[model samples]
Target: MLNRVKRFADKTPFSLTTPNPQEYTLFNQAILYGVLIEPYFTKIHIKHLHAIIIDGYKLFLSLLVGIVNELYGKLVNSGKEQLIWVTKEMIDVSATRIDSLLVCLMRQIVGGDFSNGNLWLCFELVSLCLSKWDCLLQEKPVVLTSALYTFLRLLADHCRVSNNLKPMMLRQMEIEFFVKMLRDQFQLCLKIGRDLFHVPF
Candidate 1:
């Protein structure tokens, strides 16, 4: 099935399906299920996929994020962790491919009705990101930064509820560790730049 889908994607002429109203839905579902079944996202560039969509990047991103949230919900809600461990692994791999998924989602989800829609998705992603911070920082530093920045930006924008949520979020993020990490990286960058431009003393 996977091979067939790939072949179809690769061989089909874009013009033929260009006008189909359901094309984006079909593509989104196929990609979502493919990722769930075999974890095939690690090698693909999300931007490339975004370019192939008929409906525009916003709709594509919305569908992608919706599936991602669905995936997270299923993984967390499933009773047997041992059996569902592979599902978690798949989710992690997909994250590596599109490191900015959650960050990008912030733009897609901001607004008046965000509580159940965008806010909920952002909360789920922030929780997952905090839980996996150490590993994500080591393997995908950009993703970690993007996720943290997005969460912080949201807090700044929504002062009322964010004030109550700030302490919990900071605790989960291990504020001290993150601050130290940022300082260390900043110092390293400065040292590198200074050494590069240094003159004989």
Candidate 2:
């Protein structure tokens, strides 16, 4: 699939002119898959995608949302890493529906799972939220609220089950995330309502 997409990309010159809609979608799908499956060549695949992207990355992001929603757990470790990297890239570009993509990733961080991958995801996401705090608040405050609720809930589970250093580190990160949200966006935290009170400290 990557080879075929590269062949098409090589033949096609970069232009703002839209290609056939169906073909364009197919190419995006192929490239998205290639990005996830070929981590070593991610930059190359991303450059090819940028050359052909004509939809503000909406189609590519939507395809990514679907993958994160349906296949995140099944993805290999490197694939998961690439997925998060591409997500950060999309955030950098301020892609459309990026909030939804973020929410999808938040959902993928399963609570009470002390596995390394789960802990890593929790850390990565919390760090992403912290790093992009201003952009997220300005662009989609609701995603911050969602993260607040998610981490608050996860903290409860972590407190109950965690005894190791990794989980401890993740718990600390989650604490920082919600605390920042509450300190800077108290009113937004209020939107969480009764659930906020119910989360075990």
Candidate 3:
């Protein structure tokens, strides 16, 4: 599948004239689908995408946001894993609108839903924020503010199920995330002040 898309992309003239925007978008869409669906060949597919990429991954990132927004709940487990992995990769490279992608993923964490999948999403995202704290603070501090609000709300819900082992673990992680944000980025947390009072004690 990737090879066929590569062939189609290669045949499209890019240097002689501006590549057709519609065709370029189609190529990116096909590559994004391949990356999500073909786990075994993910690295090779990403490499292929990098080799042919003309837009610094803007279109690719947009397609990912679309999938997260429209099809995240129905995605298979492996596909979800790949989605998270690829999102981290995009972050590492500082893809455009990356904060929007992170915001979309954060919104997918359904409140009051203690399902494993939902908790897993929460864990992955919180961990991502923790691990990438400095980078995010520099590139897009607003994302952390959004995360702070989302997790504070989630923490309130997570507290209700603290007896369960999974929620307990997740709650602990959430605490660590909050501490790090407040300890290191106090002013940013301060911006969320009045809203903090609204979250139940």
TM-score top scorer:
2
Clashing pairs in 1: none
Tens-place lDDT digits, model 1, residues 68-140: 4555445433322221332234345443344444544445446333344445555555666656666666666
Off by over 4 Å in 3: 1-19, 198-201
Ordered by lDDT, highest first, the candidates read 2, 3, 1
Per-model TM-score, in order, reads 0.41, 0.89, 0.87
Candidate 1 ranges beyond 4 A from true positions: 1-31, 34-88, 91-96, 111-114, 162-201
Model 2, 1-201: lDDT tens per residue? Answer: 657766554443444567799778767877787788778778887887888888889999999999998899899999999988998888877888999999999998887788889988988899999998888888888999999999998898887765598877878888888778778999999999987787667
Write the residue-wise lDDT of candidate 3 on 92-124 in tens digits.
788888999999999999999999999999999
- Tally clashes: model 3: 0
Please report, in order, the local distance difference test score of every candidate based on alpha carbons.
0.45, 0.84, 0.83
Clash pairs detected, candidate 3: none
What 10-residue stretch in candidate 2 is worst by lDDT?
7-16
| Candidate 2 stretches greater than 4 Å from native | 1-17
